[model samples]
Target: MEITGNKFALIGLGDFGAHLAMVLSEKGAEVLAIDQNMDNLEEVKDSVAHTVCLDATEEKALMSQGIDEYDAVIVCIGDEFEETLLVVTVLQSLGVKRIIARATTPRHAQILRHLQIKEVILPAVDAADRLANKLLFQSKLSSLELSSDYEIIEVDAPDKFVGKNLRELELRVHYDVSLITIKRIELKPRLLGGTREVEHIIGIPSPDTVIERGDVLMLFGKKESVQRMMAD
Candidate 1:
């Protein structure tokens, strides 16, 4: 759980926000906890790097803290939908590098999607562990837990594994893991004079398919075995 040297800003220090901030800090991330309520700030002041009591909806207040420079900003307001939307809008206007907002309802989530917010989360489903994993596991884009011990995760190709093929890697025999598939990036030319990179999964990869630099490897295995493979 220890992820080193990542910095994050957590807005709205409610129960969910407070727990997430503490978990991130415990996992070696520098967290700035922000909220309008002084009590919320006081609760996590000792746990995080810095705590600020300010109205997140105010663009000036958000700018004053230089949240744009953080690795990511998480808006964790759950009760007031308007306030959450306003805060998210202000954050968007301010051009914060990355924003992850909490959606209380399906409608709220849909609205966030309309805003083109890539990461909209529900506090009820996305608890501390998931959020922590999202923020900490930069290489691990997503994961699905099948049981207490087994899971599937999509991870970026490791540096050491940039050029090798599956047969050479011997993933199953050596690491006790299975390569589900590979998500490779290819440029799709647009109608106008532009080409944008798109990710598509190379279904059921053969042993000869070589791993590339930007390839996302879908791996399935026991939790401990997966961790061991990544560490190795």
Candidate 2:
């Protein structure tokens, strides 16, 4: 998360925005947090490099702060779409290089697109999609957004492949996919109950590494390639 030499301006000091600012600061980025609410500003005063109390819709106040110099700006206001749009417009007009906005609904996202906002995030919708996929698939596969055509997935190890070495399977050549990580799990039970241990294999495993039952593998490649691999 440490983005060296990156300066970020976060508008809005709500829960999401405040947490983002803290993360960015922890990652070695200089974060400037802005909010009209004095309480919000006070809450994150010590978390970020700078905390300012100002209406983000006010162009003059924003311009006075020289936010244009920052590398990136994120608009995290959720409730007021008008204020969000105004802030995005003002930031774009000020020549901000990269602007990322959070939108609540699809309609709001469309408005941001019409204004030519480069990045719009719908966290709730995306989370719901992930959750739904997890429940329906029940195959340990999770959602991945790589591109219009390609996707990465994480899934439990296939039953047939268990106890086999990577070299014997030839995953990359045969399936056109790459394993990224092996997720391992270790369980500790109470003294009264017997203990159990579980591990999930993931990623491009070493050729010598042995695949076991109940392991999880994180794979990355084109969707078609991934499907072919899983089928094999």
Candidate 3:
């Protein structure tokens, strides 16, 4: 998605932060990548809008870079919890528009929450969860957690769902799950001759929309509700 003109500051150019910087830049956001290590700075310097090697915990150094002016500042110092917390606190004191911090553990997350940081990311834990989901659910293509209770998952349509219209399925009433959209495969002719399959989303499906074979359903609901729907 294009996020042109949006500005973001990422403090700590660890693996997660570096990757995030590249992604944000690719999406057309202006990203400032920061880290104390020159090596880390060098890695993302060409990708992001700017790269600076400076200790984030130092308020003066951060202020000099206008950290508070950005749309958001993400603290990604994963190795050192103390340093992460300190940097977050400094960002808070600087009156940053938004602050997101990375927590290495549950306890670390709790501490960040106590510090009144609204957004905390546990990248390792999230990655593990996603991997577990992929391993456990054969039909599921991907899943995104919106919160502890809710998730949006993409799954191959079950046998019973094919040829059935949404109204006939009564997904919301019976399954307690919402089908956000449907992805269908269509064949497009290639320049040489034969056709190639391309997956396209049929946006905002209606009650009469029928599910075709090989359709991928994007469903959103409580984890248990979604699991029940898929199971049945």
Candidate 4:
């Protein structure tokens, strides 16, 4: 996976933080890895564009690094709930455009959401591939709304999802969702640039249709249930 040019600042160089930094860097985004501990910074230094050891709780120190200039900042402060909240609040005050934080518990996730951080993640549960896939297929709104209670969004097949046939996944039986369509995308080489080519497999999919990792699923379900499925 490669993004031509994007920049990210990842705070807290713990296991998940380190992995996230490495993946984003490999995907061609410039990553700035930060942590108070020099050891953590050193561990990921080779994988990222820059690594800094500084106390994120100190607004002056963090601001000195020009953190707000990054495209997005990720708060990966694990275990220190209050400390995480403090850092997040300071970032919010700085008016960061996007803050993706890791919440250790559901309550923490709720608080992050309350702070208007749309991308609060569960720590320890997210793998590098899963996170990357989420970033890849997380949908942007189209000029459409299906209904008040249901809608359609394109999502990547979950990383752990084996190429399961539609019947085996039991999306409808268990989640009360409908598979609307499947879209396959490829890049078409052009003289000056790359053009996206989309091929659609729309309809009541045959039971034999199996889900693949990069395949995009167009699904319709109750809003809450669809969100749960997507979050999973």
Give the range of the ten consecutive residues with the poorest summed lDDT in model 1. Answer: 189-198
lDDT of each prediction vs. the true structure?
0.81, 0.77, 0.82, 0.76
Candidate 4 regions with alpha-carbon error over 4 angstroms: 1-5, 124-232
Report the Cα lDDT for residue 80, model 1.
94
Q: Candidate 2 lDDT, tens digit per residue, 1-232?
A: 1123579999988888998889888878899999999999898888789989998888899998889998888899988999998899889788888888888887787778778874676667656644664476555454434677666677788887888988898888888788777665545342223222333234456888787755677777887887777776
Best by lDDT: 3
lDDT for residue 10 in candidate 2, whole number 0-100? 91
Better of 2 and 3 by TM-score: 3
Q: Among all windows of ten consecutive residues in candidate 2, which has the lowest summed lDDT?
A: 190-199
Instruction: List, residue by residue over 1-232, the lDDT tens digit for candidate 4.
Output: 2233499999999898999899999989999998999988888898899998889988888899888898888999899989888999889888787788888876777777777776777643334435554455454335456677677766677765557888788888777878877765444332222222334345567888887756778888777777677777
lDDT string for model 3 (22-96, tens) is 999998899999999999999999999998888898999999999988988888887899999889888989999
Q: What TM-score would you give candidate 4 relative to the actual structure?
A: 0.56
- Which model scores highest in TM-score? 3
Question: Could you tell me every candidate's TM-score relative to the true structure?
Answer: 0.60, 0.59, 0.61, 0.56
Error of 1 at 127 (Å): 7.3
- Candidate 2, position 96, lDDT: 84
**For model 1, how does the per-residue alpha-carbon lDDT over 1-232 read when each residue is reduced to its tens digit?**
1123499999999998999899999988999999999998899999999999998988999899998999889999988989988998999999897888888865777788778776777555435434554475544444443776777877788988889999999999988999999878675542332233445668898999899987888888887887788899
**Which ranges in model 3 have alpha carbons more than 4 Å from their true place?**
1-5, 139-232
